[model samples]
Target chain A: MHKKHNFGAGPCILPSSVMEQAAQAVINWGGMGLSILEVSHRSPEFEDVVLKTQLLVRELLSVPDHYSVLFLQGGASTQFAMVPMNFLSAGKKAAYLDTGYFAQKAIKEAKLFGEVELVASSKDKDYAYIPVGFNNDKHAAYLHCTSNNTIEGTEIFDFSTAGAPLICDMSSDIFSRKINITDFDLIYAGAQKNMGPAGMTLVIAKNEFLDQAKKEIPSMLDYRVFRDNMSMYNTPPVFSIYVAMLNLLWLKDQGGVSGIEQRNIEKAKLLYAEIDRNPLFYGTADVEHRSRMNVTFLAINKEVETGFLKFAADMGIVGIKGYRTVGGFRASLYNALPLSSVEVLVNAMASFEKIYSDKTVLELE
Target chain B: MHKKHNFGAGPCILPSSVMEQAAQAVINWGGMGLSILEVSHRSPEFEDVVLKTQLLVRELLSVPDHYSVLFLQGGASTQFAMVPMNFLSAGKKAAYLDTGYFAQKAIKEAKLFGEVELVASSKDKDYAYIPVGFNNDKHAAYLHCTSNNTIEGTEIFDFSTAGAPLICDMSSDIFSRKINITDFDLIYAGAQKNMGPAGMTLVIAKNEFLDQAKKEIPSMLDYRVFRDNMSMYNTPPVFSIYVAMLNLLWLKDQGGVSGIEQRNIEKAKLLYAEIDRNPLFYGTADVEHRSRMNVTFLAINKEVETGFLKFAADMGIVGIKGYRTVGGFRASLYNALPLSSVEVLVNAMASFEKIYSDKTVLELE
Candidate 1:
């Protein structure tokens, strides 16, 4: 069967070899004659998988030695609440930049713990662009931002590299690019995007950020519980973490983050250029703030949008439907999306333009 | 290669077919030519999986329509905090029955939200037995208990199910029994036990209980979010839930809860009977409060325990080691544990008995 070019926002595409190796471990892990799922997280073998996965993340992003990496559940969504619960103490307020649907969710969650001031917002323009030069409080504990707006295809071009300890929800574009880890106080991402599978949420936090937690919070939700135990607070998502470890190893083998980032830049450029050059389609995300990880565009002729969709569907471009909130097309270009897949999407776009342009001209005359 | 039994507490054993189906879906899901992991949770097909998984859960447990089934992450460990975060309001004391490690964790989390009263406890006896006569408080919001203690090898004979809106953490023995689902207001279990794999927690709650959630809780932790969205508020653990649904369907094919309950009872009886009949082994956990799912036993000859473990290991009886907190041998007979596996454990015990008896006589002289 031909592989489809998957553009899912999350619970997204993973390397084929990672899936195969993961499946093999499901039946019998290593030579232990037991499934990896059956092994104890406390066991040395399972511990190594967790350690190596964290190490790979550290190495990929060049994470500082003072920071800790954690594998959590509930994805980036869970962190929406946990961030406030841990840090939003003393009736103090936190600043958040509103970009897309997830930003709205984070804002809502933070409101429960303490005050959340919307520092900047692109809601007026339907989150079609990333808001910059945010109004933030100097007294605020931290400034939160989503590195990549998954729904809106907007990306932050420049951020406060050293201000109020930046906390980023990098769920969409963590290891896909080379990041200056020291710039952010804490960063979290679900493994489904650019990493490996669902079930594990990767959290990287500075040691000092751990001091923000109040004593009243639950231990499991506390960063200290995970940090102290070394992400072994509970039996982790073993199989997911193991596969993520394999994916990280795979990523490392492919020239680390720098190499992949360059490839991602080129892939997104190829696909976005096809949308820009074609009269049949127009890109949605602001050209200046376009995400390098996701290419979002709308069909130029609304009446023929269904026809374009059908054409793309026939060509095996799956999960290209933009979020309902921002209807059109969105091709997520995560780390696992190879250059070949991007080429395929570009070719599909060209083929659609050739088919639709002739029909549109006849109607206009 | 033979498949060995996996018994590492949570993230434990799973249905063999679930893994096979999950692996297949990674390549192509329902002819979509995309990995199941690559589909958006917002999509209709993924939503179908979510709804169907919930529907089947209701059917399997004979759960009433008033009850809502929620799939969340962080397992029972997170629920420990989430329950209190949601339901603990009005300064009313919630009854916490400290049965074992998980129960104590819940108690610790509850203290953060509101006043929690330790209504009953088994801690005095090192959590080896379920306590008796938990006073049902008319003023109490809920009475929480751990139905089966995975570590302590104890289970409540009858869940204090009828009074004070009973809530139970059935993590270790959820599907291993047939119970009146209506008797409890809430029942939760992590999928690792007998359901499927780890990284997913099954929460079944009365709709009214969800309505009682305090507005102070975070939106992501709100039961209302899951209740309204049918557990698809965010991208779910696609692979984990798919595996869980597959296992649920497989259980239905195996004659549902009633069928599995009978098998669990038989499996537990087989192991416990061998322990009682043989003088070399002594059972942990009180006889009256003995768990039907996990049977923990210690060697009567103190020096021969290691030898017994080695003998059992050599004979291919996996996961026989008891929890380190309560040291001994624990044979967990969860829903996925085949009766044949119990037979293997018993056979290993029978052989070990002969060897220990001969060695003890020589040492006594």
Candidate 2:
């Protein structure tokens, strides 16, 4: 069977090799004669999986020893609540950037715990670009921002925290790029996009920062509990973590995050150039703030939009439909999405443009 | 490779058939040329998966129309906090039966939300039996109970609610038996044991009871939000739910819950009988309260105990080690554990007993 070009936004693509190995492990992990699904989390085999996965995250990111890396459930949505539940003590305020859909969500959950100051917002421009130079409260409990907006196809390349401790939801773009781990106190990502799959969230937080989190909160929500217990305070999403370990191993083989980031940049640049040069389509999001992961674009009209989607589907191009809130096409160039797939999508675009342009000229004559 | 008997307490065995299908889907789901891990949770294909999974649970359990079946993340440990965060209101006491380790953890989370009335406990006997006939507060907001203690090797065969709204954590014994859906206001289980795998939690709650839950809780912890959104509040654990659907289909093929309950009983009976008849072994939990899912037993002495464990390991019988708090052996008979596996365990026990007893005779002589 021909490989379909997958461009799903969050539960996006993964290396075929990772998928093959993951599938095999589900049947017989490490030749144990027992499926990974059936293995006890406490067993030495699974404990090693957890340990190696943590080591990979740390080694790949150059994470400091002071930071605790955790594989927890409930995705980034749970972290929205947990962030404030842990750090935002009663009567204290937390500063937030209103970047896009997820940023707004993080702010909403924080309000349930304490005060939230919206230090900056791009909602005024339909979240088309990232905001800059906004005044932030250094004295606030901590500053929170979504480093990448999966829905709006915007990413923050430049971060300025204004002296406050930084917490970022990097769900859509984590592991696709390299960043200074010391720049933020906490960094979290749901492992669906560039890491592995859904069902697990990766958290890296400074131990001192974790110690400042509120006491008496639910143990499951406590960052310190996971940190202290090596993220095994409870039964983890075992298979998800294992697959993530495989995917990360693949990343390490490709020369780690820095290597993958170059490929990601090339794929994004190739697609964005086609979107700009093609007369039949236009790119969404400001060029400066556009995401290297999710490339949102639009056809000149609805007729062409619907036709192009069907046209792409016929070529085994799937999961390119844009999120409902942002109507149009979103070709996600996640880490696992090959440059070859991007070329196929770009070629499809150029061919459709030629056909449509010729048809329009003939009608005018 | 020889098949190993998997009897790990939780994250236990699944049918080999289910594992095969789950593995295939990970490589190429439904001939889509995309791994299930790479598919969008919002895609129609996966939407159908979530819907069918819910339908299967409803159909298999004969769940009433008033109950909403939801698939959520964070396992049962998260449910411990969510249960009280949603139900236990300020100034209202919630009654709890302290059955074992998990039960105590649930009680701890509940105390963070409101007053917790310890309705009953078997701690006096090291959790060797299920407590019975203890006075309960009917005026409490809700009554919480763990139906099966995975670590204690005790199961509650009967339940009395004392007129309070009933909530049960059936993490270890949910699909192992058939129960009246109307007996409780809410029922929850982590999918690892009898359903599918870890990472997903199955929640079936009466809609009316959900309405009484506290407002202003975090959306992830709010049962009503999940009920309203069809459990897609935020990209539900896609792969876990898909595998669970496959496993549930396997259960349906095996004549559903009641059918599996009989086989589970037979497997439990076979192992427990051997534990009783063997001169070198004795069952740990009270005879009447012994768990059909996990049969906990002790050996005649430390030497024989160490010897039997090694003896069983050589035969590829695995995951039968008992909890440290109650050590000897714990042969968990979850639904997926075939009677053949149980026979091997029983035979091992009898063989070990014969060898040890003969040694004892020779030593005495």
Candidate 3:
């Protein structure tokens, strides 16, 4: 029953305890003798789930009182359209910074809502770092960024501060690090990455940003609709939220965000150091803006990448294959991934180098 | 443990066998040594899950080649918006028949995208039946209907044709019946109900309707994105899809839609007949429009309702409580619910009636 340190991207590894608790709830939830999935979302049992999740999120992230936390259905992918649809009424254009594949998707979704100006993009350099030279467009309704690029293994170390109600798709990095809530009026993440699982998108939006929801907004898509209903407008993925609640509870038990921040820093440091110290492996992301959650690397020789991946897979390791959006290895170290797992991954890498080198030595001998 | 037959609403009952399969997959999926949740959705193993689910759905429902099946996150609630955003273009109005709460929510969402007309509504009778007076708006985008009203226990026995492209929200009663896919251009159901669990929404749309997707639609929300990527535009809810797959497989093994429809018809009949036989309880909804999915009723004496519910709960009956939107008792008989469970409910009802009658006779004496 030992869960392999699961590193699959989104719908990714959850804490063992959270999974166990979630599994139990699926059977006899809160002693109600009903699966959490079958409970009325409006019932006090579920309402408590909604309220406690919001309160815990606020407490963990230090969210301001006015900011609303919505437990939405679609992952951040849905928010890509929603952000502009609800917020794009004021202006004809919105500023978009494409840091990675997901940011590009958000930009594409935003354009459907309004005219999009590409203020900056790192696609020119294969999305290895936060794009530079962002010229602010004051007329733009909001500025958008993806805090952590899951595919490209890069991140925005510090958010751009030109500040037109900064909107960020923090799908991969929220709850992974501490953030100043005041800097961004709207920040959202698909719960899968660091929070819990797929199908739940966690959003924290300022009250002002929400008041901008156009009158004809789709009642279900309307963030305000969720705000009014406390995200129970219609059955809001009860089991997902239930599991997410357990994850948030697990996060709190793990000493909240700050405690994990220190551990994640060390996990990232150890992996990156091994990648850098070894000549057989190559790190992809820019040194200044590497991600703490996913480590991107490649075998120095591309011909053996498949063999190396296979070798890693044979050794109780899985889901480390890089996103096809970027071809290489991506070791996603989310909150539940202990430093021990990172050591396991790093150990495999060192052994990989030794095995390949010794094979060549044996041939020469 | 003894898992009660969960019958709340959508996210209702899942087959115990399916739940057992899900429990097994949580640890080792497809002999992959990783939890199904930990598999890369982009990988071939999970792709089999995504593609095979569509195949099973097509086989089970007899979906045509002209139709495309998609597994998308964001639930049916998100579909309310996507349906309009995509189809309601070209200055055409969309006609939505509001049968109940979710239908009303969908109507409100349609207005956000473009012109929307309330073609029919049951609100006059508190959504007791599918509304009357269908109009053929020659220029309308689609005529939308909630095939089954989960909260009100009302349903359209078959698809309604209003001389426009038909869109149906079959969230609560999709797989329970044999659906004519050609009658509706688009059909969506959140997997919680008869489909499987929560998080995933099953979208079956005609290829022709999808071909008409207007440009500038958010890539993620765009049916075309899912159509093109085969529902992997982003990481799908792998675990949810896997569960749905198992549920569908189980459905097929039990003789597919025809078999399930027969069983469901019988279960609804037996329970409704029992309710009608008893003077103490009368069924909700117009008899002609009653739903086979959720059977709702009220006691002649309001005082007896809670007692009945508590008494039922004590007998391992879960999700018997009606939606607070319309309180009484609702026995949801999704496809996963066995006819034996309905018998369990009927026997409990008879026992409750007997116990209450004896107590009343004692008091009178």
The best candidate by TM-score is 2
In candidate 1, position B199 carries an lDDT of: 83
Looking at candidate 3, what is the lDDT of residue B111? 74
Better of 1 and 3 by lDDT: 3
Candidate 1: what lDDT?
A: 0.82
lDDT of 3 by residue, B83-161 (tens): 9888888778898888898898788777767888988788988988887667768678888889988889999975756
- RMSD per model, one decimal: 1.8, 1.0, 2.5
Interface RMSD of each: 1.8, 0.7, 2.4
In TM-score terms, candidate 2 sits at 0.99
Summing lDDT over every window of 10 consecutive residues in candidate 3 chain B, give the lowest-scoring window: B30-39
How much DockQ does model 1 earn? 0.65
- Please tell me which predicted candidate would have the highest lDDT against the true structure: 2
Fnat of each prediction, in sequence: 0.66, 0.82, 0.47
Point out where model 2 deviates above 4 Å: none
**Local accuracy of candidate 3 as per-residue lDDT tens digits, A1-365:** 44576667766787777766766665567777666656667678888988999998999999999899998877887888889888887546888988878887788777767688888888888988887767877667889888898888898877657747799888888998899998898999988877876778899999988897677776766789889988877667777777778888889988999988999999999999999997788899999989999889987777558877888777777788887767888999898888988898889888888888899899899
Q: Candidate 3: where are CA atoms >4 Å away?
A: A1-5, A90-92, A132-139, A160-162, A362-365, B122-124, B131-139, B158-162
